[model samples]
Target chain A: MDSLLTLLPMLVKMAIVVGVLLLLPLPLTWMERKIAAHIQQRPGPMRVGWHGLLQPLADALKLLTKEDHIPADADRRLFAMAPVVALVPPFLVFTAIPFGTPVQLFGQEVTLMISDMNVGLLFILAVSGIGVFGTILAGWSSNSKYAVLGSLRSIAQMISYEIPMGFSVIGVVMLAQSMNLSQIVAAQEGLWNIVLQPIGFFVFFVAGLAEAQRIPFDLPEAEGDLGAGYHTEYSGIRFSLFMLAEYLVVVMLAALNVLLFFGGWNGAPPFVPEPVWFLLKVGFFVWVFMWFRFTFPRYRYDQLMTIGWKVLLPLSLLNILVSGLWML
Target chain B: MEQAFFLLLAAVAVTAALLVVLARNPIHSALALVACLVQIAALYVLLGAPFLAVIQIFVYVGAVMVLFLFVIMMLDVRKEAQVRFLRGPLLPGLVVLAVLAGEMIALLLHSTRLHAVMGPGQPVLEQPSVADLSLLLFQEYLLPFEVASVILLVALIGAVVLAREDGASAAKAARKEPRGAAR
Candidate 1:
């Protein structure tokens, strides 16, 4: 009972983290539709509620009431498990990321993050691997040829891109000389990593875009080619889980990009609180994600592979060498 | 409390390992292997080697296991389980297993003696960071590390050669024989 009581605050904090993540996707979905509509010269989601702000809510209601699907040929257990498994790893990565500098609460420092491990960046990379498993499992369990093919593309893309992403991060780590996310953030208070490692930042952002499978890099869920790709068999809430994870990965990567490259919570501010600054920086990157979605045509399959390996990989390796020399 | 956590992990690890072998479907077996690997990573965390635990997940569970699942899914090995388990190599397998088990038991006994020499519970050693491990690899075990990497490079080249050779042979077989090609 005592231990449980002691653990209550931590549990509540975790609940808040997950709750905020869940709620963010609603507004994000609405914003995505609105932005896409404006870009294409049309009004989007104006009927559901005021400016379609409540559209996500209506969509949620519809998804919840829809019949849960289980195909007859599908493996029963893995089919059920895939959506949930997809959600866990990104959430785990979220915990290690620091939202802002620690705040003072009752004369003690209260951190916005769940835990600050010395190897927080490594933890993020490791958990992302698990997310890849979740994607592969979803494809295999669906027992659909299209789903399997999409998943194969995703696996190859993720594996190849992860190398560049890892190299890009190593450059940042070398500059910062620490893997702790908060320390990395603190180190950027003076000049930000962007000024020092611009190439690394660009590489990290592109690799992150690929890692999340957004837009041009979204071969795994290529709607036109693979009939919704890797998730053709899914419907209702199970399908929503994949979308939710997709948005969460986007948000998480945006926040990480802000923290790593841009000055995290460091701005020309005498008014806004630190967390708000962090959010604003993240918000800018979120808009960038939407902008990229509308602008580019999706790459062909082989082209995507070539860019990941031949282009980004070599560039990231060069960035690491440049960063090392610059730091010395 | 620590012991309780350890017990929980141990039970899950053993059960998942059993499922890895006992489950008939190859996909199920691969998933079981993932479970077992995750539990082992948790055990590493408990042992205060957090760096090792994360690497274990990153390299083995995250990357290698995905590849394993891919190959298994592509091969569709579920229909190939017609033969009885351990039928052909039953005797030698049992002998090897017994010897392994005996070695494990002896090690456990030796560990208990070592504990007696120190105290009841094993003390927590100073935690090593990633920098320390990297330094050790580059500075102390530099030659061995370079040699290992060279070996990996060799294996990578070998795999490419073998794959190309197989593809060439399959093309030849298809043109000449029209059946019994590759498979």
Candidate 2:
């Protein structure tokens, strides 16, 4: 009975987080299309609802009703499982992300986060890393040349960029002297890490873009070359799952950027709540990501690899050195 | 309850390990290995070493297994499916397996003696905090740690060198075989 009582709040929080993540991509897809259309000097998605507000719902319905597809040559089991493998890890990542500090609800002080491991940052990184398997499995199981090539490119890009991404966070970890995300945020309460570690922020942002497979880093799904890349063989709801995962990753990256660099939930003006500040910051970052997607051209695969290995890797290492000295 | 959870995890791990060996498809075997590794990671969490568990997933399940899958895919091992897997004599393998099983049974039967030495209700050792673990790794065992890293670096260089040589030879062969029909 005591354990059940303890578990109830967690179950509630999990449901809320999952529900929010599932619904987030609806508005996000609409916003992304609108932003892309405007950037290209055109109105977008006006047919479904006001400014195509109901467009994603329509898309969801169409996708659900569409015939499920599997190429005859494809591995049946893995093909069916790929989208799920891709989707779950990104949702799992939110288990560690804190939207705000603890708040009183129903006479209980409930944390905004689902779990607060001492190694929260590492936990997020490790789980998110597993998301690559989805792409790989999808590509392999499809038994298509383009899918294979795209997945190969993606895995290589992800693996290369992950080095710089992991290293860039070292500066923040050193500055905060803790791997706990909450503590890292607290350490930045006086001054954001971005102010102290601009180079780290730059490397983290670029590598993060690559990690999330956003343009100009989206070589894995390069439409011009790979014909929709790893997901070329997917259709309907399964395809939507992959898109949902991608959008969730974008949100995760945006939220992570806010937490690590911009001081998560900090700098709230009087009468404004911490979570509101956090959401505003995260929203701005998400917009910035979309803005970059529209503004920049996709990178050449070789060029992407070079930037990750040669430029970002060394820059992040240098930033770590500078941060260590600054700490001293 | 804890014991039950541990048993469940152990059962899954053992099953996955068996699948890794028994599965005919190389990709299936690799994925089974991943499942086994993940179960081991859960066991780490059960034993209260979450840092180890996370690293296990990050390094082995995430990176290493992905590489394994890449190699399996790149090799185009679909044809390898038709080949027989177990070729060795069964008697020696069974004898070795029996001996190992006997040893494990003996160890389990005598585990009470080991517990007696350690005192009651203290089954698992307390894991050190991450900071202390890092301190031990960096300060106390710094030499060994550095040496291990240097060895890894050397192995990496060696792999690159071997791969380069293979690529060069393959390129030479390709150049020599003009209008080769047997590609």
Candidate 3:
């Protein structure tokens, strides 16, 4: 009975995190559109509700009310499962992320995380990678040439960039000597790991952008060529799910960059509190992501591959070497 | 409770493994492989090696399997085509599978004996935490790790060369005059 009572608050926090992540994508969609509109010197989403504060809510309602369509030629089972597959991984990755330090609740010290597995970083990477399967499945199951091509491109782009992304983190892992996010943040007490591993940080930033399929590296979803890319055939709520997953990926990437490179939840003054500092740091990266989207043109597919392989890969390897030497 | 959980994981692993082998569609096979890998990771967690489990999921399930699914999908292999089974050498294939199955079953049954040989009632060693694993990987496994890097470099170079060869061949084909023009 005591144990059950102790577990209740932890479960409640877990529910909140899941709910917040699900709801986060809605506002992110509005923000992205508004940012793009503002950059182009146009008014955006003003009529919906208080500069379109309720725009996402309206959009969600519309998508919910829309008809769910499944093409006759499509692989029925996989097509149905793809969106769920895509959405689950990002949500699951949120489990290991420590939003705040452990607090005493009902005489039990419970951390504000769904789970703090020993290999939290790797678990996040693994689960996030699984999200690619959904994209691939959606593309293939659509039975359209454009969808298949787009999905192939996405998979290749992700795989190519992931090598550098993983390699880039090798330096940080070396410096901190840990895969645990909390420990990594704690190690950055006096000075952040980013100070010592600037090359790794840069490589990770670039690779992460590519992994998230943001502009500049978004060749898979290149509107000029592949139409809507992997989700070309998807419509209604299915399309919304894919869109939500994309924005969520953007948020996840920013959050991960904050946790990995920046001192997560740690600030100089210590007055701002850890969670607030974490959110601010994450917000900074999110803004940078938006800025990049506005500023840069998309790279040619070959160019993207070349930069990932020839540039980021070798640079990450060198960063790892330098980190090792520095440690010695 | 632990036994039930372990049994559930085992069931998932076995079912997924069978699906990977038996699925008519390559895409389905890949998904099954992902399921099998995830279940294996769960088993690794039960065995008190959470780090190994995560790495297993990360490297094999995440990176490698995604590549496999990508290749399979890109090739657009038709699921309707009947797989040519045991075309010439049925006996050898069966023998090989039998041997493999026998070894797997033997290992499963004798694992307890093997554990006893290591020591009776000896505590199962706690795996090094993520921090310790990183330290040991750098300190002790440095040589092998560097060797792995070299191997990856070689593979990267090979892939580049192969890609260039294909590009050159395509360019040559494009440069050739039309056969009708020659006529």
Candidate 4:
């Protein structure tokens, strides 16, 4: 009973997080459309409700009602499994991220995060990397030339960017002398990592953009070229599952950026709570992500590879060297 | 509870390993291998080595398996359902499996270290924290760690050298053809 009582807060937190993550894409998709439209001097989806507040709801209904189809020659089992495989890893990543400091609940102190594993940073990186399998599986199982080519390009892009992304965090790890996300955040009480390791922040942000497959790194889903790329054959909820996963990744990256570089919940404004502060910072990054999506043109495939390997990789390694010298 | 969890993980790992060898499609084999690696990582976690478990997933499941899938996909390797994997009498394979199982049983039954430390009723060993693990890795086993890294570096360089030779030959061919010549 004592153990059960202790587990109650964790179980509740998990429920809340999972609930929010599922519903999060609704608002995010609406936001993306509105932003993209506004940027192009247009009112987006105003007919749905009050400047299209209910647009995402309508979209969700349509997707839910749409007939899901599997291509004739596609691998039936893997085709059905791909979206689910893609959806899980990003959700698993949330388990390790600290939302705010612990709070008292039911006479027990409860952490905002599900778990604060000592190797939280590494665990997030590792688990998030596994999300690639979903894309690869979806593409390969579709049994189409476009799907295979798109997935192959995506895999290459992800693998290339991951090296720089991994290296970029080493500077923060060195500065904090810890791999725990909370510890890394706490270490930045006096000064944020971005102030000390600006180059690291830049590299991480760029590599992160590529990792999330946002434009101009969105060659994997180049609609112009591949007719919706890996998901050309998918329809209805399966396609929406891929979209949901993408949005979740964007949220994950935004939250991670705040935690690693923006001092997480640490800030001025004593009246505001810590979690709100974290959310505000994360929201700003999310906006930046959306802004980039609408603003930048997609990079040519070879250009994307060159930027990842030639530019970002070298820059991250150099940043590590500089950070080490500064720490010394 | 821990014993039951370990047994579950071991069962899954063994099954996944079997699937990896038995699956006709190369991609299926690769995915099965991934499942096997993940189960092994879970076993690592059960053994109280979260760092090892995470690295196992990160490197093996995340990076290495992606490469394996990439190669399999790029080459368009598909189902060879018609081909027999073990194209001979089953006797030789059965003998090998029997001998391996027998050796394992013999080692478990007779090894003093196993009996002293890991046998039933023996207390479990204390697990080292990640900090302790890293300290031991960097301080006690630094030379071996560095040597392993060097070995990996050599392999990487060898791959680059091999690729460079192909590039040079391609470049020579391009030079001989000249710009905008006949098809």
Preferred candidate (lDDT higher): 3 or 4: 4
Candidates in descending TM-score order: 4, 2, 1, 3
TM-score of model number 3: 0.89
Which pairs of residues clash in candidate 4, taking residues 3 or more apart in a chain or in different chains?
Answer: none
Clashing pairs in 2: none
Name the regions of candidate 3 deviating beyond 4 angstroms.
Answer: A105-107, A268-271, B79-81, B84-120, B131-183
lDDT order, best first, reads: 2, 4, 1, 3
Docking class of 4: medium
lDDT by residue (B103-173, candidate 3, tens digit) is: 99998778887767765676766865866666888999999999999999999999999999999999888
Please name the candidate that would achieve the greatest DockQ relative to the true structure.
3
Name the runs in model 1 displaced over 4 angstroms: A1-8, B81-85, B88-95, B110-127, B171-183
lDDT of 4 by residue, A173-218 (tens): 9898888999999999999888998999999999999999999899
TM-score of chain B of each: 0.80, 0.83, 0.79, 0.82
lDDT by residue (tens digit), candidate 1, A47-157: 887888899999999988898888888887998899999999989998898878777776657788888799898899889768887788888889998888888888888
iRMSD value for model 4: 0.8
lDDT of 4 at A317: 95
lDDT of 2 by residue, A103-174 (tens): 999899989899988888998889999999999999989999999999999889888988899999999998
User: Candidate 2: where are CA atoms >4 Å away?
Assistant: B107-128, B171-183
TM, chain A, every candidate: 0.97, 0.99, 0.96, 0.99
User: Model 2: per-residue lDDT, tens digit, B1-183?
Assistant: 889999999999999999988889888888889889999999989888889999999899888898888888889578986665676677887899899999999877788876577666766656556787899999999999999999999999999999999999999999879857556
lDDT of each: 0.87, 0.92, 0.85, 0.92
